[model samples]
Target: MPTIPGSRTLSGRVLIIFVAFLIAALALVGRLAYLQLIKAPEYASMAESSRTVNVTIPAKRGTIYDRNGNVLATSVDATTIYCDPTMVDDPREMADALAECLGGKSDDYLALITQDTTFVYVKRKADVNKAESLKEKGLSGLYFLPDSRRVYPYGSSAGQIVGASNIDDVGITGLELYYDDILSGVPGKMVYEQSATGIPIPNATVVERDAADGQDIIISIDIDMQIYMEERLSQGVADMGGSDGTAVLMDAATGEIYAIASTPYFNPGDLSEVEDGATSIKAITSGLEPGSIFKTVSATAILENGKMTPDTEVFCPAYLAVDEYYIEDMHERGDMTMTFRDIIRDSSNVGISLSVDEYLGYDKLYDKILEYGLHSATGVDYPGEEVGFLSDYSEWSMTQAYNISFGQGITCTPLQMTRFYGALRNDGVAVTPHFLVSLPQSGETPEYETEQIIQNTEAVPTMVDMLQTVVEEGTGVDAQMEGFTVVGKTGTAEFALETGGYSTTMSNRDFVGFLPNSTSSLVCYVGVDHVPVTGAVTPIFRDIMTFAVDQYRIAEQ
Candidate 1:
């Protein structure tokens, strides 16, 4: 305890140093505790994210089959190549390798591999062999995942009906778009830990979910008949010098489509060659003026109202005047008296107009149009079915009535026209047209029950008799088949012009009918648009019907 001159000062300095050291030690310990306990999860998450990868696996799309189990559309196994750009050592080298294996520009692949993101797709749904070729090269940061590619085996045969899918196996058009949900199944996920070089760490954290495959669909189309119809339609369109053509063959009683085709077909497999407006199915989508073919409906209404019989005589002039508008027949002749049968046999526009004015008024004819489902869609299972254009009875003028009586000033799809003829063939009952035959996985079958469209059943046979006469002696004379009585009607509708009046130069020639005596329950409709001739479609109908009769071995009555 001896006090020197600087002893007290030195002791004070030591005490200050010790106090500062104690404070600093305590602060360091507290900081360590905070980091080790509180910030542990946050740091661990950051580390985990740096080394872990989560990948999505796409599910397989469904198969579309014909009624005979022929595959029209399906999904095939493929590979998807992806990569971690961060792990790629040389973007140019990898890009060059990919280009050689996959047939793409190296610069494009280079841009993808040089991306700042951790993962990017090199190619989706690549050909399996090509992907395998790249995998064998052992390119760094590259990965391959099992994928599916949509394939159409029949090509353009049923292209419009079956539709096509996009590169990612998503439906974009046709039946594919309609049933996309049912065809695209649930996707899966895979979570795995990997190294910084993009290699999986063995015995590390891994989680996976298996993908569910889509359901298969069976449609109500006979592929053989479809092929035949397409061939005939193409040839017919060429022969008639038509811009386009549509043909539909269906079960007369069931309304199940046997064959449906449209010309200028697009291949579902290769959409690049598809022309604009070629994807739409004209049978249900395009509405055309039905022309004299609609006379069958007019005749039916007249007989059903009991205002006229097949023998009911009406004076038919070359043309009938209706309030400054004259309705003339396709061909002009002298003023003559004609029975109801003769009017249909001659397809006389004047005769039908007179009968509608005297017997069936505009209001009743409008009612018959509604009753025949001409004013609405046929409620087919397919998408984009158009509801035909029909003015309300309240909106009808005297000229409009006359024009409508002769199948003018109105528009309807060929399928709708065919369905109306189907009602006549099916004893006044109109069956709903559909393409879905069955749902195999769910064991569900759609019921297409026949509904009575024509109230007076007796009028159906009388109308059928008149239609038979059309093929035998009228405009449909070319449609007559040997040893078969073809009951059909011919239509030559003037195309509407964009300017104002209808086009006198171009027309949509159509024929609709069914064999009354043949055992085959088939009704056919053939339409050629922009045809110069009047009866161009009748010969096409005759050819298709003859083939159908032979194919089905239809017994002659």
Candidate 2:
């Protein structure tokens, strides 16, 4: 061990190696500390994701029921096919295998797998058997996710009102969309450490977060009545030979929507059948210049003005001159001295105009119109609502003032029309329409029995009496139901476009009445649009109410 030339340098090199190793060890320790302590949560999450495959288990959507507890909408289990490109290492092989089961989308499926994305859904909403078949093949890169497909137990029954859900198992339209927050519950997680063969690893931990399913919705819709309305209105649209139709029912006292049906309705389960017609709730969302249906507003105006009573007399000529304008009826009134009762029953444009001119004046007529819930959204629980157009006076023509009185020159939704009728039924209380009975079973219970939208409705009873005359002896005789002292009105609205003039081609056949033949009872409104050139649907309304009373054992009038 004698120190020689360059021998001492060997020892120095050894020391250098030792120091370098110590420093490297320190650096390694520091990095480990950072990963385990400073950023532990981030790393832990990433590690969890890599070690455990988390699949979504969609919670069952709640069943939707009508007021009588009839099932209108419900949710059932369905499986969908999806692919994880990372899992399916072989693209071409997997795509070809999928094509046989998927039906005519081989290249599309192949292109989908070859994409740079980690997850790609080749198909959704496939039948459970199809997903099971794909599962049976044990395809490496494919996955099956469970979802809830909405089933309208009463197909096209309350299609428009019940609405539809999306591929995500989320509600998209109707009450389904409106109450999504409640109808869509939390998704459950299924996590398991799996081997490359897709089998659960031995002794591996499975972390689970249980999902709470969506709560059921008990709507005020009456199923049997809804069926009857759809049948009747569909017939009415056919009878009137018009294009389309809508019918809405409301509880006069509570403002609950009993039934809202539109034909031809698109299935909430399958949208492929949807067409370009004004089906669904178009009668509410699509506003139109209603023909004689608007005379109700004018009648309200006249009655509010004190210039006319239900029995008050007014003379109607074939043509009445208001300012420089001549207002005429569909049929000549022949200058008859008609009472207000006769005015509505006769549906005399001349008589209504004369009453509007003499009693309502201008401002009073407009105020009465607003009071009756015209020119506003009915504020129902739904998406895509519009406020019916009520042009201000300065924008109004002399003809508009009178035309508005007769249900022309003004625009409204079927829901708004029902509200106007609701005001008449509820003794002047303009009730806002509602769908839900309570909140989700998981959420806080709602304060049931909500109230009214209209403030001053003392004049409603008087209007009801006048409207009753229209049914008892007036123009709405077609709306009367046997064994029921029906109080209602009929409106044959000639459909017109906003930009174009009155439509000579299409019209709205409407019959709205309430039954059990008593006061403080159910009020139903049926408005049919673009009737098929076949026949009248009002009789359907009578049948529906007639059936409703008889079915529910609501005492006959």
Candidate 3:
């Protein structure tokens, strides 16, 4: 009765609809099976990534120690405070509270707390006292991470040399920059389960990859000598009313720098007010024309070529014309006959020109300068080292030759000069200057290699004797010590002006030599700039030399 008109057609239509529905459901089931069986691992990893938190563990930086095993730079445990700004209930209030406890402006904290990022740093390497104060507030959505901060125990002592690290613990300059790869240890990872809002779920299983700490480094610097040299050099600069100064002490035989400082000091601990260009280690970085100090090279060339002996005679006048220039003696008047040794002892410009041209010749003089490490970088293990400036001998005029012969017209760093002096003290065998003594390797002691620059061993003693005569009875007499044989040369040269001629008001007064009384040879170089007198730095050199001889227990005659 119900299926009257078109009842058969209606039933057929309903059946077709039912069959179509069943087919669609089967297709859906097949799709679900394919996903569950074939791609289970991929979907599982995607889900895990959304719920798990991965944190990086920074490696501990290496410790820096002086030659005597005194720790100069190290790392200390610290806490870094972080938070999810999205999870914070009231960012302004939280920032205000944090500012009161952490000693920063409230606006700065507000900006950090209101950031759109999921994670933001509130304070890194926080002080324990401040962190405890913030903890007492029991703030929500805030977390603390274990971190390490760089520390310099000796404060400003050797600060520029050791340098400083950035907030992320990357080295920026000096030895730290040079040895960054060796000093930065291996970083690690940590993963843990977290809630929807990014907070770690308590009691959840945690997996961590432990970080390997960096190796400890031992440098060749002796802190005692460093302190002494810096103190006296600072005082000398002040007393002489000079602008700046640099000093270096090295083991003549090995080229190991014992104490090297450039005034004023750079404080690595607090870098908020670091002066521009103040952190440069000028001993190896700054190059200047050394006045009479260069004469030693000429004197060496003269003797090495067999053109003159210490007793050989020459005539020195007040001034002499050469090429387009006139070379003059600094003080003495009238023509006088003097021994070849007296030329260097008196630091005579005319005498050097007469000998360098008449006897040593240009080719031999140029070769000797190259042998002294003056024409190239000293190959030091530090960053930003400079090479000496020397024109090719083929381009040399008579004036250039005479100027170089008298230590003018050429430029070299204080480190290069000290290295040359070291060669004179070490049997004429120049060594590559270096600061690193060892670096830890595979839990074993550090390894090292040696480099020699010169091979003429016999010439060392002869030059040493000649330099000794300068200190005994010449311009370097101010550097003389009571019981030690001080061998060195004094130099006073005006700064070359950028416009043309030399500066009338500024000069570099210097003394470079070694102490032979010590069991091991010690080379020292002192430079004072922007002063009127020439020998002002010699007394400073004397004080440091005397102290070194006494402190190191060097023998006295």
Candidate 4:
């Protein structure tokens, strides 16, 4: 056939343009296919977030129980009230209605309802009744979701030890804080579709992940014993009108704490009512000079080194000049010969100082103090435990050494001293004081465990016999129990002034005792601090120990 001069060029151009358009169409189709299939889930989530929100569901906290299966703390059902600010029709009116139903101020609710965001929490864990009241009004944009709040069953009993949790179920103090992660379980998640203005999309697909509840914690405390100690200590503090008082009872062989009580107790249910410095574990945290109670250490050191026997006699002077310091007995008896047992029974400050200095010297005395766990932390399974103070042997002057022998220059916590006495009860095996027996695992019951810190089995019988004499015939006569064969030591020390002296009026009176016949194996220690009255804590100790012995049905002597 025949073609015009320009026809061929124009035909070629038309073919090229057709090819380019066809390639572009195929490329566009391929890209669309890749996006719709390969990237579908990612884009879907992005779009869903624009119209849907993920809400967190808090899991129920684990139950806390005493050794006897009494509930100390637990989580109760509650509801959280929240709002999608964009969906509310009238911000002021909704706020006013919510304020009426709930207890919050109208202005606060009004501010939240007027927010430009998709969601806001009105109350994290509101009472169920309040949430129901709000729901009855059928307020737009507001929703009620299930939640949990911590509740204490026994009021203030064991308050400091069990601790408390926040509104969101997070532990803030005590064992609650110590075991927070184990107590606070996994949080759940839920995704729900909503409108642009934050209204729920009906019949929409909702994704959810169930939360796992926390593990239950079982501790060694006896609830009845805990309540008794708290009551008795509270009364003792009131009667003596002291600044503070602390008591701890433990299993002599196992070191498991049965009851630890402190005056100025707080209500864990309502933390707002806490007293000043009341929430601390004073028995484990507060360290003070332990006075005549420490004479047990001096006597033990003398016996342990064979420097003296129970019948070994020493001259007890009314005053002894050691270096620049003059050590004096509490009473003025002039100079008299006293047996080694008589020193502790009479609580002779001059006797202990002179005897320990002449016999065990400074290094052995300090070593014995540490041997009894007086200068170290008790390693209790509780927070705020302090290591009591003891000066190095290199820094000790003769006077400091003498003072330490009588429990004057050194310091020790109530828990440390309790464990020291506890060792004597357990045949000289010093065990670490602990509260947590075990944690529940795989739906099984928890078991109790014991950890021995030290052992000196031979010295214990002698120490026990001597201490029993203190209660039976000497200064600790106030701690005697008729049938149970109570053995204990007494302490009466002037409260040291922060500015470098001792308080003339206030003193720290302490008593630590144990029942030799009791199979339950109890060691009790009591300290009354900053009390103007003398002989304050020994009687309290006697009463508490008597009650505990009766409660446990310990066999009579």
The candidate, 1 or 3, that scores higher on lDDT is: 1
Residues 1-557 of candidate 4 have per-residue lDDT tens digits of 77789998999999999999999999999899989998888998788879987889899999999988899999988898888888898899898988898777999989877877888999888889888888998878888888888899998899989988887678888899888998999999877798665669897746488878898988989989889999888888878878888999988788789999888888789987788877778888778899988898788777777667788889987788877778887767888999888998889998888788777787877777776677777778777888878989999988888888888888888888888788777766778788887676655543443434334456678888999899899888878777678888988887678898788888888889888866757889988888886555777888888888787887754
Tens-place lDDT per residue, model 2, 180-261, is 8777888787765755544446777454876678888777777877777777777766666655667777777777877677
The positional error of residue 61 in candidate 4, measured at the CA in angstroms, is 1.0
Can you tell me which runs of candidate 1 are displaced by over 4 Å?
Answer: 1-47, 196-200, 203-207
Question: Which digits, one per residue and each the tens of the lDDT, describe model 1 over residues 407-476?
Answer: 9999989999999999888888899998888889999887886789999998989999988888888788
lDDT of 3 by residue, 1-557 (tens): 46589988999999999999999999999999989888888998998888776767788899989988998888888878888787788888898988898887999998888888767888898876778788878787787777888999888888878888888778887787888887888877877677877676788746478877777788888888888888899999988878889999888777688889998887888888887676878988889898888888888877777767888888888788877677888776789887888888888888888988888798888988887678888888888998968999999988888889988999999998898888777767777778888775644443333444445455556667778889999888888878677889988887888899998777888989877655757888999888765446889888887887778887854
Clashing pairs in 4: 483-557
| Native-referenced Cα lDDT, model 2 | 0.72
Off by over 4 Å in 2: 1-54, 80-126, 129-147, 190-205, 277-279, 322-325, 439-462, 504-506, 531-537
- TM-score of every candidate relative to the true structure: 0.92, 0.82, 0.91, 0.91
Lowest lDDT 10-residue stretch of candidate 2: 445-454
TM-score of 2: 0.82
Off by over 4 Å in 3: 1-30, 37-44, 197-199, 205-207, 440-456, 533-535
